[model samples]
Target: MKIAVIGSKGLPPRQGGIEHYCAEVYPRMVAQGHQVDLFARSSWIHLPWYQSCRFHGVQVISLPCPGKRGLDGLISSSLGAIACLGKRYDIIHFHALGPSLFCWLPRMAASAKVVVSCHGLDWQREKWGNCSSCLIWLGEQVAIRCSDQIIVVSEALVDYFQDTYAVEAINIPNGPASYWQSDPTFSFVKLLGLEPQKYLLFLGRLVPEKCPDLLIQAFQRLTSTGWKLAIVGGQSDAPAYQMNLFKLAAANPNIIFAGELKERYLAEIVRGAGLFILPSNLEGLPLAMLEAMQEGIPVVASDIPPHRQLIGMNRGRLFHAGDLESCIQMIDWAIQHSKEMKKMAQKAQEHVQTWYGWDGITAATLRTYESLLCPPRSKVKPATELIQR
Candidate 1:
């Protein structure tokens, strides 16, 4: 199949989960003999016009994302969609809802099938600006309506789409990056220069939305002097928010804010950690937690829909979002009964193998595409009428 994959800042994921998702999935799609073309944004100021390059048989056409973010996604994907019309592609798979402006172009192309995989809706996220929120909501509405199929990362998101937009979405969680396979011979204690079996980890963006401050405060209140917290993620963008986190960290000697470790080192840290903490406000099946769970690290997460949907009630610990006391108590509980945490880690590893591993996710995604391309030939049959594989 000649597939045109639209939306993103080009293939080598220099940043963010969406880029990581494409980086993982695109190569697999290409390896399966699908001639995949990526429509991405080129940040090069030297380029005269759009440029094309090949990586693992996938053609990456890098165009400029207008105004760099919300505007860039909206425009670059639209331009890619316009160009795709003349390319005679079989499938137009757009990565995120932000690129919905292109749905119109694909909709007019009767020969092409449109599939939209919304990583998460921007408007639903609390981070969007007022103007961006309005624009995103409008775009997502068009995207959900025009696309032939919608793909989501979590059952919670699927429910959201079904209930709010009345759109049906096939659930497919994000897969792991290729680096997950190798053994880095990593030790969290050695890396942090701490005593063996002694530290808790909170990994992800250190922003207000991620609630790193809550984790910091929780660490401060915890009575366990033996256990310290390592806060790993990018620096917060909003200065005031960053200041707040730093101030909280200042009050607590046990909290260390290690900003954005390199990917390999970070993965090693995750594999070596005693526990993974996520106090995020919102998420669409966070890749960070999934990655941690894949490494068999027990998680202590925010009691939000996305986290609950992934971890379930028994798999790991859940504390109320932004509640410092609840988080502190949960941390204290984990520290005291280290054995239960280890058991939870084992459970998490098993759970990951069962449903959240990369290979399984990739296979399911392929099947979704297949189901869309090839429907049942006969008339509607009872759900039981379908033969079990």
Candidate 2:
């Protein structure tokens, strides 16, 4: 199958869950005999030594796009959809609901099957302005009515699509990257003066909806001196929000902003943490949470549906979303009962390994692709029926 993937910044996955997801999935998809061409933004294709021509085994097509937050996806996806039409691809998959706003372009101009994967409800995110939110909402509607299939990452999203749009979506949860066992040679952790099981950790984009500020606020109130809070992610088009978090955490020397750490650095950070806290008010199957679970790190997340889904599967702790008091209480309890949390983390590793295997997710994604290309001869099933599998 020839597939053109759009809606992410670029390959090598410098930022965003969707970018990381494609980096993990598409290489394997190419290895499995599918010809995949990933469309990346030109601005992200930086560093003269590092070629943007290709990544892994997949071909990379760089398109000119404004690096502006709101305009980037709209411009890139519009161009990407048109570019895919000329390529005569088998599947033109859009990674987010926002990009699916241009689904009609491919539907009319190309012979390929259109697929839209909703990572999360971007409209509900606190960062976006009113107009952008409305546009995102309209994009969701466009994806539901126009795309051949809708793929979601969590059951919460499946319920949402079914309830609101009366559209059933294929639920393929995000899988963790390669699992790494905790070890003593964590140079990054050591360099940061962090000891294993001695610091609380939070990893994700420093965005408004992620509630990193809330986490910092809760951390400040905690009386415990033994544990420090380490935040391991970069700001995603939200510098002001990031500045606000830094200001909120200014007085507390115990809280360290680790910026962005990739690969083993990221793994070691997760592995060495005493407990991982995701105080996000909104999420659609956070890969960061799954990564923590894979490393046998205990997680205390918000009571949002997606986080609840993860906690339910991994037996981790949860607090009411955006409730400072509740978040403080959960973090305190997890820290106090360290041994119990560690045991839960171990169980979470087992459960996530069993449930969220990357091979299985890749295979399922392939099956979805194949189903669109080759339907049964005897009977034609509805799009919802394809999701049921």
* Residue 239, model 2, lDDT: 83
> What lDDT does model 1 reach?
0.74
lDDT of 1 by residue, 1-389 (tens): 78888877776676678888777777778888888888877762223247888766778887765555566677788788888898887788887777875687788875788888888766766556788778777778878778888888877888998999777777777755544433355554465664435778888776667887777777777787877788787755456788878886886666777778765667666666787899988887788887777777888898999889767758888999888888888888988888888788788767666666555555666666666677673232221222111
Give lDDT: candidate 1, residue 341: 81
Report the lDDT of model 1 for residue 132.
Answer: 76
Best prediction by TM-score = 2
lDDT of 2 by residue, 123-218 (tens): 998888899999888899889878998999999998999998888788877787774454568777978978778999999889988999999999
**Model 1's TM-score against the true structure:** 0.90
